[model samples]
Target: MLPWIQLATAKVPGGGELRLMRRGEEFSIRLDANELMNSRLGGSEEALATLACQKLAGRPRPRVLVGGLGMGFTLRAALKVFGTDATIEVAELVPEVIDWGRGEMAGLYGDSLTDPRVSILQRDVGELIRAGAGRYDAILLDVDNGPEGLSRPANDQLYDSRGLSDARAALRGGGVLAVWSSGPDDSFTKRLRRSDFVVNEVPVRAVGKRTGSRHWIWLAVKT
Candidate 1:
């Protein structure tokens, strides 16, 4: 059996450290004891893009915003499903994650980062949402373990009413806001409706099969 090796470490804003670890061919990014993402597990993250892209069919030159860049799963999925005409912007708060995509985890990312239709920003996704109104065809958030913040305290605001409102305002009419979570959150579903988004909760398999841990993807459309 191969032992896990520490590849690199980075500090998260608001006090937390992310450690990148590898065991044979598998890699994982962890915050303290919690594994935030793994190179081998990105089914729900990929679903977060596809589900939202499905709602965007027929929308010309669609523009999408992705809140996280964990191993490029969502970004790669979005690039494939959103078409070549579509433009995708990824706001990754942590810089090291981006480095990982281009460096240690390059195999998992492939050429997704260098795609001409995609842009990578080192800023927080919330700032971009707050600054732009009706700016995107879809806003996909796979940040911080769902609506509940795990790595950073500020991530909690992204799922709050005000944050939800900002996300709504950031989207074009009929645009979708998709969020990926490790589990279900009934309260968050209710809050999405209260924020004026028509919400649907879809369950997904972590390994993209019917036999793994169930994750949730929330598809909330702005009417």
Candidate 2:
């Protein structure tokens, strides 16, 4: 059996450390002691873009904002599902995560990061949402452990009432707000409703073969 090797490390802007690990063919990005994302298990993350794109079918030249690039699963899936006419803006607070995608996990990302329609912003996604107004057809948050902010304390702001309100204002009419999470959050669902989004919570498998821990995805369409 091959042991996991630490590939590299980086600092999260506010506070915290991210470690990139590789074990044979698999890879993982961990924040402190908690594993943030893994190369092999992206089922739920991919679904975040797919489910949201479904709701946006037939929309021309759709513009999408993806928070937290992770391993680029959601970004890649968005390209495939949203077609060539769409443009994607991926906001990743940690620059090294983007580097890992293009460096250590280059094969996993392929050309998604270089695609003409995609722009990788090394900015806090929350800031982008606050500045955007009627600018996106979809806002996908593959963020820090959902609303609980396991990776960084500041991530909690992305799911708070003000954050939800800002996100709501950023979207165009009939836009979708897709969020990826390790599990369900009842309170978050209530907050989504209060933000005036028509929400649907979905359960998905981590391994993609319909086998693994049940991960949740919230597809909330702006109303």
Candidate 3:
């Protein structure tokens, strides 16, 4: 077995550090001791964009805001569904993650990053959500493990009442706010409903197959 090799490290905003590791052909991004994302298991992350894009289908020139750029799986999946006219704004707090995608894991990202419809924002997703109202047709968030913060405490605001409200306002009517989580959170589901979003919780496989740890996706539509 090939031992895991440390490729690069990036400091997380607020605190902590994220280490990029590679084992053979597989790559993994870790926040401290916890694994954030693995190159091999991207089913749920892809679902995060696909599910939201399915709801936004037929909309002319759909605008999407992707919170995190984990391996570019979600962005790639969105690009597959959207056409040349669609615009995707990817907000990644850590710049090194983008570098990894353009460097060591360039093949994993393919040309999604260079696509004309996509814009890379090296900033916080929460700020983008709060920047304007009704700016996006779909807002996909996969920033943390779940609603709760892991790497940065500031992430907690994104899932809180105010954050959800900002997200709701940021979406056009009937637009979707899809969130990818490591697991389910009933309270967060309730909060979505309270924020006036029609919520649908979907269970997806981490490996995009029938057998793997189940990850949850919250597809909340602005009502």
lDDT assessment of candidate 3: 0.92
Off by over 4 Å in 2: none
Instruction: Estimate every model's Cα lDDT from 0 to 1.
Output: 0.92, 0.92, 0.92
Candidate 1 lDDT tens digits, 152-223: 889999999999999999999999999999999999999999999998999999787675689999999999
Ranking of models by lDDT: 2, 3, 1
Model 1 alpha-carbon drift over 4 Å, by segment = none
Q: Model 2 over residues 1-223: C-alpha lDDT tens digits?
A: 9999999999997778999999999999998998988888898899899999999877999999999999988999999999889999999988888899889999989999999999999999999999999999999999889887887889999999999999999999999999998999999999999999999999999888578788999999987
Give the range of the ten consecutive residues with the poorest summed lDDT in model 3: 206-215
Q: TM-score per candidate, in order? A: 0.98, 0.98, 0.98
How accurate locally is residue 174 in candidate 1, as Cα lDDT from 0 to 100? Answer: 96
lDDT of 3 by residue, 58-167 (tens): 79899999999989889999998877789999999999999999999998888899999999999999999999698999999999888977889999999999999999
Model 2 superposed RMSD (Cα): 0.9
Q: For candidate 2, what is the lDDT?
A: 0.92
Show how many residue pairs clash in every candidate, following the order shown. Answer: 0, 0, 0
